[model samples]
Target: MGCNPLHALYLGAFLPRPPPPLPPPGGKQDRARAIEAAVMAHWRAVRDWSPSRRMIRLASPDQEQEEEKKRDLPRNVVVEAVQHLLEWGRQRDQVRGEKHRRNEEGLRPPPSSPQSPSGGSSSCPKAPCSEASQPASNSQPSSGETSEILNQESVNSSPAELDSGVSEHTNISSKEKTPSGLSNPHSQKSEITVNERFLKDYNNIECIADGGFGCVYKAHHLLDSTQYAIKKVKWAIGKEEKVTHEVEALAKLSHENIVRYYTCWTGKDIFPSEDSDSSSGEEKLHKCLFIKLELCKLTLEDWIYSEESTKNYKDDAFEKFQEILKGVAYIHEKHFIHRDLKPANIFISFQNIIKIGDFGLVTTGADDIPVKRTRKKGTKSYMAPEQVGQEYGNKVDIFPLGLIWFEMLHRFKTKSEKSKRWEDVRDGRFPPEFIKAFPTEKSIIKKLLSKEPSKRPPAAAILRMLLVHLFRSSSI
Candidate 1:
């Protein structure tokens, strides 16, 4: 007969309890011991709870095999799952550590040099990284200390190495010692030099012109005593990319009719010191872009309207117009459109050569396709009808060319005539007097001022026609 339930309960209470769970496996040896204890306990429980002979006889080989398979399956799956989770955790920690390191590096102050007995920071006198390699945290250098380090490195190393190292650090101290008379009150003159060669090559900077973008200064070269125009653009925070793009476009272009591009310089300067009475301290930095260009005697607008330009120089004027056409045609050939082709932007050298300047409004694309622009650009008086409202092609330049030609020919005696001329061109009317004086020019003007862009001739064709006229006039 089965044991009474009360007796079974009393026996179970007396039986030894399983050992407290082994302290979580410390090492390989501990883990092995814990696993062994678990297996032994399981075997002992099975042994103590003996089954009847009939039960043992009914348990077949197939049933034992199935039990073994079930036991093995969980062990393998659990081991693999644990390993995968451990690996994932390790990778996550590594990624987080890398990000933390970078953040620390960015926040760390520039390494400073040791102070000398004289109360000034000692110079490196050797390589820059001699101390840099040691560690940045160990030394907390002031801006003057860092500047001294760079100056020392520049003296010891090649110019190329100096440039590469210094350009990477935006807060480099300026080396300029002398004060300039033209310094702006809002901006401090920091001696931080970019392309020191440029500074040494050119001197005596005088402001020649100022525009929406920047100021132009007339500078003379020390070597050849040649004059050049240096455009100084104060760097605006978000407009850096635009300035870079303009520089890239100018760099790529190489034509006699296009303004020559010189080297570009970019660097930071301290805003003019606010405290006149106080000694030097850290000041806010301002970035600037300096573009050097060929100097021109005057713009087309200056030449055309000057009091001394009144004498009949029709042949000279036509020749100048021909040069302008050549420049425009060259620009079109290079797959670029000079959207702002007004008199102010057309520069004339002392040699009387016409060159297209101010490529700020230039655009590039295939000649056959019209570039769509919503915002109006170029001078209002010179804008093509399509440019004013619709998508325009390279032919938009032709309309402005017509206006330029009219101005060259009529020599608008008064402001009213200038206004009336604009009205006539906008209305597609050629002044009868102009038509009668130069019939051939009138025909050319009529086609250029066509209201429909497709009706206007390409710059290349206009150049060819102008060349033919030049040949005829010269031969006569």
Candidate 2:
């Protein structure tokens, strides 16, 4: 049988080989199972601690007997407890190793230093052949060319960067964010192309996402060498109203919390369609709108599910929520409504600023209410109760803000926890345990999610309530 590592520290301090514990029935797993409630509680405390921190509390040769009495953990219980910590260390090390490997392979490009203010170009990865004009056929850089570009980037990088193992990408999925703050890190899974004209000014075009509307690409500006998110949307030649409404909404609103809109242009672009008859006819060009947008680090949706959630959470939800409210307030003040306000639409920038983007479903009219059939325009899960085939106003935004508040305050260990929390909070009733911890939040959540649209507080009002709550809590 293998030596119990715990025995080495506690028993083998003086002797070369530590004496083994009396073997209990059903082996290690059952011996662990057989531990009583009190012993198990101690095991849990040890299990919860980090390995380095665990070492500090462990028994030392000089103070062995005193430590044993303090712990009150039996030899057998120690064996099982130590096993748990070892497993934790192993898992942590494994994760670190994978991240290191990814860094070495696909070094994340550093964020361009802020020089041109808007461009954010400086001390960053230089784009390959920014002036190289390719033929129309080679408009979009191929996957191979992208790889070569990344390779060239690494080769051209300063020797100091290479030695320091500077990464150009952040593992947002893994919560291993870097100074570079690159989100939706590259993988060759999806093969989408960028518009030829867009490629002329923006090099290193990589598809960030593709949906029914169109695709969003992460690109580097040729002159400024700054990174930007270019959302290239497709509309049926006559059905360009959505794009128009979105542009109008964005153009009217200006706030620090809002996503920065650089510029936009319209053009016709070739798109692959199932209906196209390749052999019989030439490819058709479709109406497309390209919007140059501020490239944010990651969406709020990414932050919620990150590893820091639940117990490890940084608890910056309110701070983030405040910024969202500011942006929404400005939109409402400007006589617009973010009809589709959700975690996915909220963005976090490199400087950790909150930016609200994706105004595709924004509405301009203040008292305008869409028909019953159009109620399904926003995400169903975050949709307000009054928004269902009813005459709703700006307060429609408040309901989802309430939902987002609950999501931020509650610690959901799993996806199921998150889903269940949504169901439980509909009546303004939170779990007793949660309420005991956050006594004030339940009231705010209730006010925001009131069934009547008229009852729901405006974004500005909610901001006041939050500020008041923050002051009260800080004073306490």
Best by lDDT: 2
For each candidate, the alpha-carbon lDDT, in order, equals 0.64, 0.65
List model 1 lDDT by residue over 187-232, tens digit each: 3321322334446566665667766666677887766678998776
User: Candidate 1 regions off by >4 Å?
Assistant: 1-201, 268-286, 471-476
- Relative to the true structure, candidate 1 reaches a TM of 0.54
| Residues 1-476 of candidate 2: C-alpha lDDT, one tens digit per residue | 32234333434344333344554678657655544333444343443243643564564655645543554546665555555444434444544565455555544443322245665344333442232222213123344643443443222222122222342322123233323433323321222443555755666778776766677789888667799998888876666786777777777777899988888998766555432667867666677888888999999888887764445352588788899899988888887767788888899999989999998878764643433334656887888876676456777787899888777766567878767767668767788887887777888888888887777788888899989989988899
Per-residue lDDT of 234 in model 1: 67
Q: Pull out the clashing pairs in model 1.
A: 112-141, 174-191, 174-192, 175-191, 176-191, 187-271, 187-272, 188-271, 188-272
Residue 103 lDDT in candidate 2: 59
Q: Model 2, stretches more than 4 Å misplaced?
A: 1-191, 270-284, 308-315, 367-373
